[model samples]
Target: MEGIVGYGAYIPRNRIKVEEIAKVWGADAPSYKRGLMLEEKSVPSPDQDTITMSVEAAKNALKRCLINPKDIGAVYIGSESHPYAVKPSGTVLAEALGATPEVHTADFEFACKAGTEGMYVALNLVKTGDIKYGLAVGADTSQGAPGDALEYSAAAGAAAFIFGRENIIANALESYSYMTDTPDFWRREYQYYPQHGGRFTGDPAYFKHVMGAAKGIMDKAGMKPSDFNYVTFHQPNGKFPFRVGKMLGFEKKQIEAGWLVNKLGNTYSGSSPLGLTAILDVSKPGDMILIVSYGSGAGSDAFIFEVTKRIEKVRDLAPKTRDLLDNNRRYLEYGEYAKFRQKIKKAS
Candidate 1:
């Protein structure tokens, strides 16, 4: 009976179009549109950080679940871009959530996949009856080098899920994880942005880990690509997932069902979960959804979910990703984007 009680997502109100970035740097402007398959990327305001984003996502999720904050026995935040270097962001989130003193809370970091890793931990706790309900959040404000290709695509967003035994909306059927010492992408403690091995990240890192975990889940679950009604992957860029799907015998139709990257860019920790939220919006009862997440250093986690009758009833509580994208937005200039990203500093 342990399953997802509710889910929510938070996308910022501002965006930066790839075309604008392209136009600003000249005709070729890094080929952001062609290379990353991103049209616009979400940009959080100065006041909004990982903590604020997670709180918003968690609040929406709690509203959908209709559970009192006191009932939440545990809260976990997964992020690499925490607002404070020393304080546990989860503690700040728990206070914002108004959870009781009995709550157990902590933060988690595993590169970009940390959020999904939090979900996995929350699921296990709920399944064991150690907690009646738990909240797992994934959020990030990722950065890239000033002129690096990742600059345009790195974005911000957050997703939250409440796990419990009652009122299950989607049941986790099976999960598989693949880990390796692949250093396709990484940033050191003092580094401002991540370093990538370029083509190597695609061939042996992202593709290899994602495919291994995905195939492992499919093999264990006895399901095929056709069995899933929707499939979502951690989108570093628009082309990687599409190309990986092709290699695995899945067509564009299956991959495009999410189309998250084209609109939202790579949200780092929020990427796959945001894609899953997109799937849930259009998914029907009994539909199957498969999710895969990848992080540099590198590793992949794959999950299989089956929607239930309760999903229809709970659908109205959260605004879908499409609604979020269409309804709210502010535009920023390249210089403003640079400032927000801390690529440039203002005079004191």
Candidate 2:
């Protein structure tokens, strides 16, 4: 069976508090902090972008696995923040891991769900005997328009999953997806920041696709929400996930471990995938995990996994998501954030 053998995530140390952003816009900080349940959001340094972050995350995942880099036959990177508009981040990632010259590589984008899309494909390829192992990554150094609501929540992070048939950690049981021509959020070519449908993004877009996909996967696997030990959904904010979980008959405890949006903001494509990584870090043998990811185009990918005893052997090989979130954080003022994000463009 196809299963996750190794996984890792990278969250940048620099951060911007909601108050710092709200102060610049002359908006109420208490409202955003309480409403979105966000205090501070991660930010990438001037030296870090999607490619560099992806490489770090990939290296961490590789460290947890017992295999040669040359054995990974496929490399897929899913992100909305690729450094180049026309280049493949996958090649750069594969080359960095020394997995090239004999691997299939590609870049993926589906708003926030792109990472799970890559994982879905890699798992299938391994199940089909196409490769010994595959690396799938979801990451973003997201952009938010100045003075817009997104400015408070769009954040930077990455998660990489390595799947193989050997020394399985979490055994994949089933998968499903739901999609439509929803236009709740989008970014046009040459646009620096994305546009959203405001309140329209809630009921009709994010919630619908997420719940639909989650239900579809449970039905396909002949399991109920109560059968899972943990559940995680695409977290646009800290609130959406819990609301969705309750609607789908999952309890607060089921989703709490993976509900990291409050601390990290929405990492776009890395959101739910990173949540799964968090669950894996502490999941016990035989525990079941259900994950559903939503992207803005928009669509959702639902997956069911049952943890294996092998998980205990490697869960500590790399850093846990919580440690990174709690470690040394360099706070940034609005001006410093603008400088780091390149929001203040200098004339050539």
Candidate 3:
């Protein structure tokens, strides 16, 4: 069966807390924290961007599988923050991993769903035996207007997965996607920051599509919430996942393993994919995992993965997601964060 041969995640070391951002905007820090259920968000350095993070993440995935980079048949990267408007991010990523020349590569974008969108395509390519291995990456240097509601939680990170028929760790059982032209969020070309529908992004957009896909997959598999050992939802904030999980009959414990939003904030395309990496790090054989990712253009992608015995053998081959998230961290004030995120204008 086509399944995950290896997987890895990368989160920047620099972080900025919600209080720091709220202070800068003269908003009530406690209210922002309580309302968003967010503490701090990861911040990319002056040097890091979508391409650099994707390279680091793909390198970690390669370490886990110990696969020859030259043999990788395809590379797909999904992000809203790709450095070049005209160039493909996958070409740079493939060259960095030495997977260039004779490899298929493309960049994808669909708001937050871009990452899994790439994963969906990569998996299909591998499953059809058109490629020996395919690399799928979801990464972002997510942006929010300074002092806007989005500033408190938009963060940076990347997750990469390798798929193949042999040496599987998590077997791909079933997958489903749901979409609508709701336009709850968007960024037009030449726009520096994304505009959202505010409260309009809630019921008609996020909840509806997420629930539709999650229920669709479970129904297709003839499974229930209790049938899965772990479940991860797109963590736009710390609140929505828990709220949605409760509504779906998933217990807190089932969702806790992948619930890193309070500390990591929203990594956009990296949200649910990063959560799944954390789950895979600790999951045991025969454990069932369900992951549903929501993208703000009003869509969701859901997948069912069954852990195999191979998981244990390859679990320690790369850095664990939680370890990268919690250890050796640097906390930044709003000033430094703005500089790093290039929110400040420099005199020419």
Candidate 4:
């Protein structure tokens, strides 16, 4: 069966707290904190972007599986914040990983769900025998207007998963997707920041698609919430994943391992994938997991996986998600954050 052979994630070490941001915008940090359930967000350095983060994450994945980069037949990167408007991020990434020249590569975008989109396609290609192994990555250096609600959660990170039929750590059980033309969020061709429908991003968008995909996948697999040992949903904030889990009949204990938006902010495309990496780090053999990701155009991709004995052998080969998240953090003040994010334009 085609499934995850290796997985890794990269989170920026720089962070800016909600209170720090709130202080600049004259917004109430307590209210913002309570309303969104966010504490801080990771910020990319001037040298970091979608491509750079993807390469780092992919290298980590390689370390886990010890797979030859040249043997990888395909590579895909999903992100909205691709560094160039006309160039493919995959070429740079493939070359960096030494998977170039002979490998097929492409970039993908579907908002926050782009990461899963890449994963889905890569897994299917491997399943079809079109390729021996496929690499899919979801990464974003998300953008938010200086004082918009998104400024609190738009963050940076990347997650990469290598799909192959051998030595699998997580066996794919089933996969599903739900989509629609809902206009909950958009960023025009020349726009620097994205616009969202405020409260509208909820009912008709995130929750609806996420719930639909989750339930549809469970029904297709003939399983229920109780059948899975762990579940992770796209976390736009600290509250959404928990709220959605409750609505779907999952307990907090099952969802907590992957609910990192509170401290990490929303990594958009990396959100759910990174959560899955976190869950896999602690999962035992035979454990089942469900991951559902939402992108705000809007739609969701859902997958079910059963852990294998190989997971324990490779989990320590690379940095764990929590270790990258919690250790040696460099906090940034609002002004420094602004400079790094380019919120304040420098004279060119």
TM-score of each candidate?
A: 0.96, 0.99, 0.99, 0.99
| Candidate 3 Cα outliers beyond 4 Å, as residue runs | none
Cand. 3 Cα-lDDT? 0.94
Question: What Cα-based lDDT does every candidate model obtain?
Answer: 0.85, 0.92, 0.94, 0.95
Least lDDT summed over 10 consecutive residues: which range in candidate 1? 23-32
What clash count does candidate 3 reach? 0
Superposition TM-score, candidate 2 onto the true structure: 0.99
lDDT of 2: 0.92
Model 2 misplaced stretches (Cα beyond 4 Å): none
Across residues 167-255, which tens digit of lDDT does each residue of candidate 4 receive?
A: 99999999999999999999989998999898999989999999999999999999999999999999999889999899999999999
- How many angstroms is residue 99 displaced in model 2 relative to the true structure, after the best TM-score fit? 0.3
lDDT of 2 by residue, 151-270 (tens): 999999999999999989999999788999899999999998999999999999999999899989988888999899999999888889999999999999999989888879999988
Error of 3 at 76 (Å): 0.7
Error of 3 at 148 (Å): 1.0
Residues 1-348 of candidate 1 have per-residue lDDT tens digits of: 788898999999889888677676564644667766778888888888999999999988987889989989989998889877788999988999899588999898878888888888888899889999999998999887766777778889999989999998899898788999988877788767778898898878898988998999999999999998888888988899898887777777777767677778788888898888778877888999889998888898888899998989988887887788778688998888877777776687
Q: Model 4: which ten-residue window has the lowest total lDDT?
A: 338-347
Deviation (Å) of 169 in candidate 4:
0.2
lDDT score, residue 48, model 3?
98
Tens-digit lDDT string for candidate 3 (162-237): 9999999999999899998999999999999999999999999999999999999999999999999999999999
Checking candidate 1 for backbone clashes, the offending pairs are none
